[model samples]
Target: MTEAAACGIDGVDTGLADPPLLVADGVTRWYGHRLGCRDVSFRLWPGEVLGIVGESGSGKTTLLDCLSGRLTPSDGTVTYRTAGGETVDIFSRPEAERRLLQRTEWGIVRQNPRDGLRMGVSAGANIGERLMAAGGRHYGRIRALAGEWLERVEIDHDRLDDRPTTFSGGMQQRLQIARNLVTHPRLVFMDEPTGSLDVSVQARLLDLLRGLVARFGLAAVIVTHDLAVARLLAHRLMVMQQGAVVESGLTDQVLDDPQHPYTQLLVSSVLQA
Candidate 1:
C-alpha cells in the first residue's frame, strides 16, 4: 500500500467517518545534532486510542511529548479540534492559552507518579485541582466529586485525605489517573502509564485505564514500550524506529502481520522475551 493509504491521508477506511480530534503534520524535533523525532504525522479521531510503540531511545516518548505540547517540535504543527469545534495549532497558541487548554480540555498521564501527582497534597486535593480548573467552584461539590473519582479508580474513600507520598506506587498511579480524569478531558496524553509498576500492578492499572477510557469515550495518545500494554489499550498502533514511524495499522494487524522488517523484529523479540 502507498504511504498515503497506510497513513489514512487518502481517506482509507478507518471504520469511522468522524473528523479527527487531533492532527500532527510533519512534526519533527531535534536535540542539538541528534534527532528526537522526525516528520511524524497522524490523525486521531474522537473516542479512539493511538498507541506509539518502540524500543528505548526510539523516540516514541519524544514524539509523544511533542504531540502533548510538552516539547516544541523544530518543524511542523500539532492541530487540535477543540470541544468547541475550533481547530487550533497548539504550538502556535500563546503559552497561557495552551496551559489553559491542558488544564481544561487535555489530560496528561506521566510515567512517573511523582511527575503527574501532587505528592505534597491530599489525594482529594489533587483531584479537586482539576475540577477547579474546569470552573468548578463549590467547595463541597469539588470534594464530593473527588471522592467519587477516588472510588471510580478503585481506591478506598477513606484514603481520600491521604497524601500521595503515603500511598504505594500503584495507589499513587491510580490517584494520578483520578486527578487527570476527574474533569472528563476530551483528549488524554499518556506516557508509559503502567511502565513503573510491578507485573500485577501493571495489569490492574491497565485494566482500570481501559475501562475508564471506554466509559468516558476519550481520545488518547499513549506511548508505551510494552507491546502487551499497547495491545490491551490501543485501537491502533504506530511503530517507531530511530525517530521515524516505520509501520502503523490496527493493533492486531501490526502485531500479527507486521509489514516492516523492524516491526517484525520488534514483535518477534517481544514474543520471545
Candidate 2:
C-alpha cells in the first residue's frame, strides 16, 4: 500500500514525521496449506490502541502471535522501535534478544489468565518475577512495587501472599495484568483479555484496562471477537475476515459507517443481537 493509504487507514495525518512503535509489513502466517493470516500490514503509534476484531477462525489470534514474536510468519516482517529509538525486525533478532525484549519492553496478556500468570506462585511473586527479570534486585523494593500493582489492579494488597489459583477468574485475570504491567512495558499484546469473564466482571476489568492503558500511555494491539470490547479500549479498529483486513479506520468511524460488506455485517450483527 502507498504511504497515503497507510496514513488514511489509521485516520491520522502523521505525515511520517514520527516513527511508529510497531510496524507489521505484509505479515503472513500459514499452516501448511491452511492460511492463518494473509498480508496483514499496519502501523501502531506510541500510546495508541489498535483492536483487531474478527470471529473465530478469522485469524486475528494468528496475526497477533506473529506480531508478538510468539510465532514466525511464513512471509513479511514485524519490526519494532525500541525504547531507545532503535528499530529492529523482531524475527531477525536472536532468540535470546527476542526473549529479552519480551521480558523487558513488551507484555503479552493471554485470553486465559492461567496462561499468563504463575499459578503456583504467590500474587506478589508473579508481579515481582517480571521486575526481577528487568534487573530489579532489592527485595523490599520488589515486594513493595508488587503490592502497589496489586492495588492498582483493584486486588487487595492483603492477598499478596495468596496463589492465583485461589482467586476468582476475574481476580486471576487482574493479577495477570498486574504482573505484566509491573515491568512498565511500552507495548502490550492482549488476546481477548476479558473474553472468559462474566459480564459484570468483564465491565469492571474493561474499565480497569482502559484506565491502565491510558495512564501508562501504552501502545497495544488487542484481538477480540466482541466489538464492544474494541469500541471501549481501541482508538482504531481493524476488521479482519477470512484472514485479511477488510477495513480499518478510527474506531467510531469504522463501527458507525463501515465500508466493507464484512464490516457492515459485523456491525449489523452486533446491533441486532
Candidate 3:
C-alpha cells in the first residue's frame, strides 16, 4: 500500500470512518552517537492491542517511549488524533500540550511498579489522583471511582486506603493499571505489565488485562521480552532486533510461523527454555 493509504491520511475520515488513534512515522530515538532505534513506524487502531517484543536492549522500551511521546524522538514524528477529531504531532506540541494528552487521552503503565505507581500514596489515592488530574476532583466521586477501578482490577475495596508499600508486587501493579484505566483513555502503553509478578500472579493479571482491554475498548501498545506475554495479549506483534523491527504480523502468524531468523530465534528461545 502507498504511504498515504497506510497512514489513512488522505481525507479518509469521511465522518463515518474510524480514524487511527495514533501514528508514528519514521520515529527514532538515540543516545549520543548510538542509535537506540531508527526508521521505526507503526499505527494503532482503537480497541486493538499491538505487542512489541524483543530481547532486552532491542529497544522495545525506547520505541514505546518515543511513540507515546514520553521520549522525544531524535528523528521523525509521533502523531495522535484526539477523539475530538483534532490531529497533532505530539512531539511537536509544547510541554503543556503533551501534558494535556497525558492527563486525558493517553495512559502509560511502566515496567517497574514503583516507577508506574505512587509508592508513597494509599491505593485509593493513587487511582483517585489520576481521576483528579483528569479533572475529576469530587471526593465522593473520586472515592467511588477509585473503588470501582479497584474492583475492576479485582483489588479488595476494603484496603483502598492502605499504601502501596503494604501491597504485594502484583497488587501494586494492579493499582497502577487501575490508575491508568480510570481515565478511560483511547490508548494505553504498557511496558512489561506482568514482568515482576510470579507465575500465578502473572496469570491472574494477564487474564485481567485481556479482559480489561476488551472491556474498555482501549487501543494499546504493550512492550515485553516474554513472547508468551505477547501471545496472550496481542492481536498484532512487532518484533525488533538491534533496534529495528525485523517483522510484524498477526500475533499467531508471527509466533507460529516466524519468517525472520531473529523471530525464529525468539520463538526457539521460548520453546527451548
Q: What ranges in model 2 sit over 4 Å off?
A: 1-3, 6-15, 271-273
lDDT of 1 at 19: 74
Models sorted by TM-score, best on top: 2, 1, 3
Off by over 4 Å in 1: 1-3, 6-17, 271-273
lDDT of 2 by residue, 1-273 (tens): 434556665566656788899999999999999999999998899999999998999999999999999999999999999999999999999999999999999999999999999889999999999999999999999999999999999999999999998999999999999998999999999999999999999999999999999999999999999999999999999999999999889999999999999999889898543
How do the residues 169-222 of candidate 3 rate in per-residue lDDT, one tens digit apiece? 999999999999999988999999999899899999999999989888899999
Instruction: Report model 3's TM-score to 2 decimal places.
Output: 0.93
Q: How accurate is candidate 1 locally (lDDT)?
A: 0.92
Q: What is the Cα-based TM-score of model 2?
A: 0.96
- Could you give candidate 1's per-residue lDDT for residues 130-204 as a string of tens digits? 898889999999999999999999999999898998999999999999999988999999999999999999989
Query: Candidate 3: where are CA atoms >4 Å away?
Result: 1-17
Output the better candidate (1/2) by lDDT.
Answer: 2
- List clashing residue pairs in candidate 1: none
Total residue pair clashes for candidate 3: 0
The number of the candidate with the highest TM-score is 2
